[model samples]
Target: MYKKMIKNAAGVILSLSLAIASCGMTVNAQESKDKPSVTSNSLNAGGRVSKNQSGATATTTFSRPGNIRAKAIVYYRLGEDDYHSEDVKTNNAGGTTAFAEKKVSNANVVGAKGEHRVVYGDIIWNDETHIGLTLPNSKLK
Candidate 1:
């Protein structure tokens, strides 16, 4: 009876271990499926002093094609003006496709101080209609 009990206990332990491991894997798989799909280029400041940088590019790949939007805080210095920040919205019209991308440009150059700087403060994607997770900042050029 003692030997039989030992064997049964070992079997139960093994089964429990397998169940725990499988549960962990299932959670990871679900997380991956829910992850958002988005990519972008570092903010680009364009032209010589007094000229506006065209704009940065954003690329996105969704599991399903749908309209998506992202927001970025753009820090810029135009010509001789003091550096300032603005929140800009960029969008993608998936249009029944799984992939969509856009290059957003603000061509308003208000000064000509011959020097300019562009930095991205923060960027976030829309989980649905509102902002979702904030993306990591990339190295600026």
Candidate 2:
């Protein structure tokens, strides 16, 4: 009986190892092939829209092409004239699919001048429709 139990345990472990080894580890973005196609991209200072007198500086756009209902998050870099430069996240609102920002051309971190990490601030992907902290003021302003 002891020998039989040992064999069974070994078989179970081997089976479990094989199962885990065969599984994939990538994020499958779709629940079903029939669902709405989903897709995402980074929006830059100028692409699909133009900054106008009505407070429109930049615009970002993305699409979910899958049949399944999908969500998108856009990280925004906040910049204003009278305030220190910083970054924030916001969701798409009110018939708007584009993210507009004043653009930070000269924003940098403390003690990291000349370094990409210090100088360049990235607008991270917060969630579906951009949600993050606001940025600092624009030096150009």
Candidate 3:
């Protein structure tokens, strides 16, 4: 009877140890997939044409706060309805990348002139959480 009880107690301890270890591993894996830190460097729209008064440039600058590689998408909205975008693949070492365009013409303007909003986001390991920001608006020209 003594030997049997000792065996049963050992089996129970082993089972609990396995359960605890598995739980810790699961938690660590989830933490590793957490959302990445994103930083907005700058967003601007400039270079308006004086004669036509219908052209300008949009620039979106952003970076991640880690060494891991990630993907970013910079979105631009000119006026109220005109929208444009650019995709960037961040360097593995992690640094700021800029996306700029001067393609907006007279046709893209909502009215005589409008303000442009530049927004950007960085996705960590392609996870669901997207970190981003929308900078202050500037004249679309």
Candidate 4:
């Protein structure tokens, strides 16, 4: 009877040890998938997707608070010796936003002094005919 009782207690201890180890392993499994979870608040403002004035999307999100400012600027050379620009302001929660142009910017106009066409390589001129997408990261990407 004494030997039988000892064997039963050993079996119980072994089962409990296995259960406890499994619980610890489960916690780490969930963490692995959590870190890479992309928080797109900077890319999409709440629920609004960015739109490009050039009729093309140039939306992009960098690892914020690490590699970007709360606000950013994108420049497009408008004409001779001039440029058009846009600013993407990070929301109050440190999330940057994109313009309808899908370009990130601050509250200023900063265009690049290089040669590039507007989105689509086509245009319908009017008073609102923009020279190009306010922020053109397509080529950069």
Candidate 5:
């Protein structure tokens, strides 16, 4: 009886370990889905369109806090003359990083089959300088 109980306990422990390992993997996978699609060293920025193509998120990392901000712009366009821009900005006062994100549900223009054209993220220094970077376009359905 003692040996049987030990074996059962070992089996239960192994099963729990496996379950925990699988859960960790799932969390990592979800995080990778939100990873930035584009990064720019010059601007210290990253940007990506949402999986559903509804909007985008932008991030800028800074070494030290100052009069700095991060800007994210999501552009939608059906043609050269038809386009829209949605932007969001966030300021970093005394932190180590600054980021901004915005989602536009009505990104499509009226009566037009528009697409989420592209995403741009930038770092603005002292509210005067804008170092910008672009990411590849995301299609809209």
Candidate 6:
């Protein structure tokens, strides 16, 4: 009887361990899928929209200060037909590797979804004039 009980308990423990491990893996996968950022060969940028969808904060980081002036632009849509964008500029000081960020507000506008992108007026040594966009994200009510 003692041996039988011990075997059953071990089986239950093993099953619980496997279940917990699978749950952890699922959570990690979902987290990775939701990452929000856009990058270019020379620069990296990202944005975060407010909970109420009234505004967003845009950020830009340079791999190396390539004597370029850049802008982080937040583009958003209202309802289904209205669209708007707001942008902020980098400091433009030469030869500095620092992250630039700006909070763009659209107090009159509110929405549930948007995208972030970076644009540069000056030249990037080996990069396009504008970087790709971040995955569109929805605001939580």
TM-score of each: 0.22, 0.18, 0.24, 0.22, 0.35, 0.37
Worst 10 residues of 1 by lDDT: 95-104
- Model 1 over residues 30-95: C-alpha lDDT tens digits? 344423233223332221211124322222323222334332222233333323223233233331
Rank list by TM-score: 6, 5, 3, 1, 4, 2
Cα lDDT of model 4 by residue, 1-141, tens digit: 999999999999999999997885655643343221122332332222222224122222333232222222234332333233344443223334344232333222332221111111242111111222345442231
Model 1: what TM-score?
0.22
Worst 10 residues of 2 by lDDT: 111-120
lDDT of 3 by residue, 68-127 (tens): 322223233445644433323333332333333334543332111112222233432222
Q: What is the alpha-carbon lDDT for the whole of candidate 6?
A: 0.39
Instruction: Write down the TM-score for model 4.
Output: 0.22
Worst 10 residues of 4 by lDDT: 112-121
Error of 3 at 134 (Å): 7.0
lDDT of 5 by residue, 1-141 (tens): 999999999999999999988884545554454444443344343333332244444444444444333444444444433333444444443222222222345444221111111122343432211222222354422
Please tell me which model should have the higher lDDT, number 5 or number 6. Answer: 6
**Which whole-number lDDT from 0 to 100 does residue 134 have in model 5?**
26
lDDT of each: 0.31, 0.29, 0.33, 0.32, 0.38, 0.39
- Which of candidates 2 and 3 reaches a greater lDDT? 3
lDDT of 1: 0.31
Clashing pairs in 3: none
Q: Is candidate 5 or candidate 6 better by TM-score?
A: 6
Kindly report which residue stretches of model 3 are placed more than 4 angstroms away from their true locations once superposed. Answer: 1-80, 107-141
Model 4 has an lDDT value of 0.32
User: Tens digit of lDDT per residue, candidate 2, span 1-141?
Assistant: 999999999999999999998789555543222122222444221112222212222222323221111122112233333322222222332112322333344432111000000111344332222112223332422
* lDDT of model 6 at position 74: 34
